[model samples]
Target: MAGGLVKYRHLSRDSAHRQALLRNLVTSLVKHESIHTTWPKAKEAQRLAEKLITLAKRNNETSRRRATGILYTPHDLLPKLFGELRKRYLERPGGYTRVLRTEPKSTYDQGASAILEFVDGPKDLRFAMTAAAVARDRALGRKSNELTLKNRSKVLRYRDNGEKAFDDMVKRIGKLDLAGVNKGGADKSGEAVA
Candidate 1:
């Protein structure tokens, strides 16, 4: 009865399972701005994530609700996705996410691993936290600052893994020369006095 109508990958899972898998993958990708997954899965998740990001670019009540529906994670990333993430990608026409291939865990699996990440999403702990902060304010609809182990551990891991890179960069460059920063010598207070 069915013919030529199959448009999406099944991921070797039943309907419900596949839907859940894609949802979780996309959720993680959006929340953390990166996710390590197998090639096929990464591609599928990227498709969905890209669609959602385009939707986010609309930056409206409908888009927010729709993205919230698709990325229905407990942490409620809709606000951040619609606000910060949307703003970041507004100027770009498309290609919101990138897929970077990495070595597979083993040759037997014959599956390549890839990292799916947002093009301009946060790459450091401080900004990552800040990106999610404004959304958190509206996402939770409350004043409580409590968090779950999964989220707490996620942020902790981000901080942990990012520290090495931060330290290495500081050692390599002494300090980053952000644009608009004064190239002149610093004053006695070690501030850019121009």
Candidate 2:
């Protein structure tokens, strides 16, 4: 007897329905780098997309096979995703996607609507970490002025000369002694400092 048994099912049960959903979701994600959807589907797709990215990160034959199996996409596209895209995100440890809510269409479905998207690369991580550090410092009642100044200079340098410039700025800032500076331009040694 099938007593107390329950069969699990999906919202889109048919093959055509499922395939359409997957294709459209994947295409939208690739083209726009984000998409808005119902909370349940968005969460599921986010898991799938991250898995694909992890496969891409591996960049090997096995990973290619795995991605092909999971995504059911053309093998040719794997190289671009795994080679160029993977390299771009090499330094990031995960949480590559972000979800931000938007206004709902109806009160009945007024659950959290959100946009899920990829965060470009490790550069975003640096910016996020810097922001977090500044916030933490402020919360702890410690001086974050030095970090703020250093991050400002780094941002300016990056805007001027790109990632290499930012790297150089970080190195230079790391070597500095920041205790001497006050709210004014004068150093502890009573000298005008840049």
Candidate 3:
């Protein structure tokens, strides 16, 4: 029945090549806090990224060595990974990385693409999306829906001073011309255009 089969995507690469590719991806992810790539690659990298974060959280010699082995530029990234990222994710239990499917980034490659990012970081996509939703709801004079409410909670759950951050984002988005109000700086209700 193949009940205990070890499953992993090969991504059309030999073992050594695949390992190197994953290491590079994880290194970039750690440096930038987010990365965009093919869905399969992003999914595979997410596994390694989660493990790296777990290692950082441990903050021990063996864990640091293991993480260094996985990362390409350990010298440049180790401090950030062990210090900032470790502290950032210390409170969370699991699910450190998120893979969000996106349209193909290039016309040549029609394959599914995605963005891989760490949760609760400054560049969290879901957080910005949730704040935008809240702003739109306010601008439209409508209450937030159940899904929006749930997403809001998820975005704010682990964040420190989440309410303040969310309010700030909503205000920032509100200042933009989100709805039909004053489109293109014409001021739709103006008496005349000079």
Best by TM-score: 3
Of 1 and 2, the candidate ahead on TM-score is 1
Worst 10 residues of 1 by lDDT: 174-183
Top candidate, metric lDDT = 3
TM-score attained by model 2: 0.51
Residues 49-83 of candidate 3 have per-residue lDDT tens digits of 99999999999999999998999999999999999
Model 1 spans with C-alpha error above 4 angstroms: 1-6, 106-108, 124-194
What ranking emerges by TM-score with the best candidate at the front? Answer: 3, 1, 2
TM-score of 3: 0.90
- In candidate 2, position 131 carries an lDDT of 50
lDDT of 3: 0.90
Give all candidates' CA lDDT scores: 0.67, 0.60, 0.90
RMSD, model 1, all Cα superposed? 15.7
Weakest lDDT window of 10 consecutive positions for candidate 3: 179-188
**What's model 3's lDDT at 163?**
94
Clashing pairs in 1: none
Candidate 2 structure quality by residue, lDDT tens digits, 1-194: 65566342244557677656755565566545668876656666676678778888877889888767654454655666777668756766777666655677468968767666766533434444455555445434487777675864543432323456444544444334344544455776888877
Cα miss at 143, model 3 (Å)? 0.6
What does the lDDT come to for candidate 1? 0.67
Judge candidate 2 at residue 76 and give its lDDT: 50
Return the clash pairs for model 3, or none: none
